[model samples]
Target: MAVLGLLAGCSGGVEGSPVAAERWDPCSITPEQIAATGLDPEYRDEGWGKGIEIPDWGRCVFHAPGGTAYPYGLDVTSSEKFTIADARGRDGNLSVRELQVGGRDAHMYKTETGKSVRDCSIALEVSTGVVVFTVVYHTVDGVDSCQVVLRHVNDLESAIPAGPK
Candidate 1:
């Protein structure tokens, strides 16, 4: 009986309830919009890939042209559970700057610490929760990742719903 009690205590199970479904689907982005970002519209990958699923989050990744020396990827995600404040509080988020995207509250940040080129992300506040645009380059090509993500966000701003009034 003591052994059974110890086993029960050792069981680490998930706590609390699952989050609600995402209010906005990032996969709903149109092909034209993807093309406008200089990525291949047909190479869209939905979800986290490899059959992984994250509750209350919708994601889509658009890949750049193939047969290139420096290929980049653009990932767009919408979350009903995470807010801008949550993103700001996350660790490893460097140089976080508040900005406005199409009149909506937004933030741009870098993932790495040093000056070397690295991944960049921009989170825009939406009515549902938050929508994030991230740019990851496979190789260094002197391209500004932040500017790339900012341009993509600007191009897709019309598709994203406005935040609270």
Candidate 2:
């Protein structure tokens, strides 16, 4: 979780754009969504919005009970910057892909550590902003990181309604 500790200040390559109040609360994700990722929704840190300003994005982390593994948890946040193009860039980068899930355009990236795959993220643009879901787990031997991320994306798409931007 050391990586998680230092990510609070990262831009994630996104430039902040004021999130319209009517479109997004900017710091809310249902406990059900957290539970959907197999983490204990009850033990959550709602401090994602802490020290975070508009457009850049606040992040939240959820973990399983008594879990000390590298990624037996999930990391989530939203950015006003569009990752659509960067996600679709095929110039030598082989891990990015464009996707259509729940009748919406999405981009997914598979991030790996050495020969072992670490995590994967799926991002979708809503009327409010870009919604990003990341799935993290230690090993992909029995668990598929990309599939896990896609499942979370599907769950989120059905739960969140696009708001006025």
Candidate 3:
């Protein structure tokens, strides 16, 4: 009985552990930055919608210009509880590649349906956690989602706080 009790104690969960606060706010991206990415700031959606919230995450979605040739939306999510490794382990992520974006550790991943690339994301390492930029197309257009995501990352990389040296 003593040995069993010790084993159970070792398997106890870590409850009430505090997670680091997010270093960056997804909703804090300025309108000028949105315009630089060819997105309309007026169409930005906070938290994707009111009453929809993900614990430990800050999220915002920016829409492409109206009546564009290839319509799409960019969802920027920041989470102190998640890391680049967490993004790589996601079930639907494919072609996960580790790379450096503007001197910061980053991961690029995408989702595919048969031969079609559905969406792409770049997860950037930040001081407190990871900020993921995902570009999702509104239609089955031929535009490369990864390129679009990378462009946004480059444009906004300076805005994201750097991790520990």
- Local distance difference test, each candidate: 0.84, 0.63, 0.82
For this target, which candidate reaches the highest TM-score against the unseen true structure?
1
Model 1 residue 106 lDDT score = 89
Instruction: For candidate 2, write residues 43-122 as lDDT tens digits.
Output: 65544556755546646666655555535555666654544454456344337878888877788886544565467777
Candidate 1 or 3, higher TM-score?
1
Clashes of 3: 0
**Candidate 3 per-residue lDDT over residues 3-55, each given as its tens digit:** 99999989868888787574578878899988887888677777756677677
lDDT of 2: 0.63
TM-score of 2: 0.64
- Models 1 onward score TM values of 0.80, 0.64, 0.79
- Model 1 Cα lDDT, one tens digit per residue, 1-165: 999999999999899998664579888889998888777877888888786878778898888778444377888999988888888788988878899999888889989735544789999888778899998876667888888889989989888877867
Ranking by lDDT: 1, 3, 2
Cα lDDT, model 3, residue 56: 78
Q: lDDT at 23 for candidate 2?
A: 37
For model 3, the superposed segments whose C-alpha errors exceed 4 Å read: 1-20, 67-70, 112-117
